[model samples]
Target: MVEEKSDRKKTNTIIFDASKKEPFNINEGYKILHRRLKNSWKVGANRDAIRQEILRTCDVFVLAGPRMKLQDSEIEALKEFVSGGGRLLVMLGDGGEKRFQTNVNTVLEEYGIMVNSDAVVRNVYHKYFHPKEAFINNGVLNRALLECAGKRVDSAQDKRNSQGLSLVYPYGATLNVSKSSVALLGTGTACFPLQRPICALNQRQNSGRIVVLGSCHMLSDLYIDKEENNKIQDIIFQLLTREDIKLNQIDAQDPDITDYTTVPDIGYLADRPFGCLEESEELPSDYMKLFELNLFKLDNVTLPAVLESYEELEIKHEPLGLIRPHFESPFPPLTPAVFPPQFRALKDPGLELFDLDEEFSSQMERLAQLTNKCTDEDLEYFILEAGEILGVFQNSSVKRQATAVLDHIFTQVCEFKKLNQD
Candidate 1:
């Protein structure tokens, strides 16, 4: 019973690596994956350097979207771990190693799997909004994957059918797989880099296994539940942990994938254009042949023909004269009026409109006139006008009201009274 427990512990333990500052972890971006994994496996994170001691305790080690560079020792340790019946799962995002600033390819390339530095994008808009969320409708490269996903795999027709398993590969790149590895999934015809590998598996006889995925998001909380992705995840884990599921040797040998072809950047080529030189025609032995005499010479070759035509028609052959054209006037010509010219009188001087007495009046005289014009009913109006004439309202802080005007006047009177008493 104790041996069975130890075997169970060894079989179900999965260690997610975080020593390289990976983006996903148990308590963070991988919550859904953690929850799903907790039901059957013992999941945890490794925050220290990857060593054989730690790898010996777990059956599978997952490196999810690591953004930091791996040490040489760590790479060697992982290689040794995988060679000794251990499973290794490495997941990367779009832009691959250069974008992530890591040297994970040092380890992946050893197994004939290298994630390309290009992104996988959909050519048309589909259920997902982002173009990087490539929806591959027929990307199953190996029939073994379909069989493991509980899909019916017909040996004849369903190998490259449109009704195969689909996946939403978000923010992912493509993989360049070689003969040493088996391409399991690919970016189908609907995506850019058409029919290229996105997931690859490498297993040796009586040795460890390694699986490389182009997209780390496929098993994250955001996309793990998406179309057939959960099934794909199950298939990946099954391939790694279980030995009953075997890859089809025929499909593994020749995957339905196209070669990685690069297209020239049109914008770059347009910016730097090269001119082509053409071979000039051989010059003739005579230099006179280079210049054609009929190109620009003034000639009167038709003059004689014109004179014969005039004599044949019995017409006068004289120099043509210009005839004066008489244009009818639309209206009678205008003549100056037979009367003395009249000019507009200058406008009357504005001085007559202004009263000199009022214009040059002192403030006291204006106040006196305002007093005469107002009565008891205009007491508030009279004070306001008197204050304006005395410039009491010049200070903006003083309110323009009857009480304020009266207060100003009283304050000035009090100051004058105080001066007299002193």
Candidate 2:
């Protein structure tokens, strides 16, 4: 059911929009980022006809859409474009209330990728990634795929699915990667996985480079900063052009997606809050100092001791002005505030304390590590606390606190599941 676009010759600009659904601010979003009525159309991709227009004519198919059951022809067109060397950028979401999972990943599976229908990737509150209500995380783009994307907001909030993840704010989910030319930028002892933004980042045997993410709204003018959304924009540019990196256009859609029989439970990652860390220049130097303090009890100087100092660093500025100054706030009321010392206190008391800053910073780092590498013993204690905290968050106005509770739940639950099954 593909809609036949007016075969417009001006295909060079770009085609951006959602599946013509109610919630997606796709068109307006393009206006904000590109700052003009984009040659982009605000059509829907979830249906057959619209999918045809997008999958066929659009040079780079940019999407931040609700769940869509792909039509066969549209799927074929997508494969053909990629096989013939066209680029695509799709941003799947937790979806609107009409929420039914689509198998976009099944088609990509032939190319060594898979996007599950029910499983939605959620982000935890933190630095480096989520800054505003909408924010961009990170990715390893195939140089050939991301060459065109100059800059675009990478992640945003879901008015419907406000289920915040705890691993990477506005970003969450599991990613098991093999080896590829995919180059990820960022450093830390442990690496976080791409939950929603997972597809576009993977490479398929068909030779097309895919740059996936946990959420699509990550790219919004509401969230864009000169330095932050590069991962999304870079890949956007890469999908529009070729020869920058090695890629193949796929002709046939992955057959598995078409089956529509296998979708199961929705929640794929652990049930608890996924703890995370994100960095942005707009916020206070120690904006994340509290999370660090609340989790591990170490100071910044000591915890990030191995990392470079924020003082020596300079963040890239946006031509349009700092992206809505999210770390600050769009709604005057949402501005982030320093917490009362006790309110920000660590949930557990086992860790040793050092200097004020170092104590908190060290604790945050350790807690991050603990979440990443939780054990049977840790799970027992965390489970007890998670139940209590979940109740607290149930009546709370704060989301970060909710995220902290979930982080512990998932980590502990993971251990609990493994142990019980064993």
Q: How good is model 2 by TM-score?
A: 0.39
Q: What is candidate 1's lDDT per residue for 1-422, written digit by digit as tens?
A: 01111222355799999988888898888898899888989998999999988998899999998899998889999988877778999999999999999999999998899999999999998979999999988898888887787877675866464356888999999999989899999898899989999999998765678999999988989899889899999999999888688887878897889999998879999999899999999999999998888987778998889889987999998889899999999999999889988889998667657777877999989988998999999998998998998889998877999899989889989999999999
User: RMSD to native for every prediction?
Assistant: 13.3, 35.6
lDDT of 2 at 216: 54
lDDT of each: 0.88, 0.43
**Span of 10 residues, lowest total lDDT, candidate 1:** 1-10
lDDT (Cα, tens digit) per residue for candidate 2, span 267-327 = 7644555778988656567666546556666566674643444435653433556656547
Show how many residue pairs clash in every candidate, following the order shown. 0, 89
Q: Residue 57 error for model 1, in Å?
A: 1.7
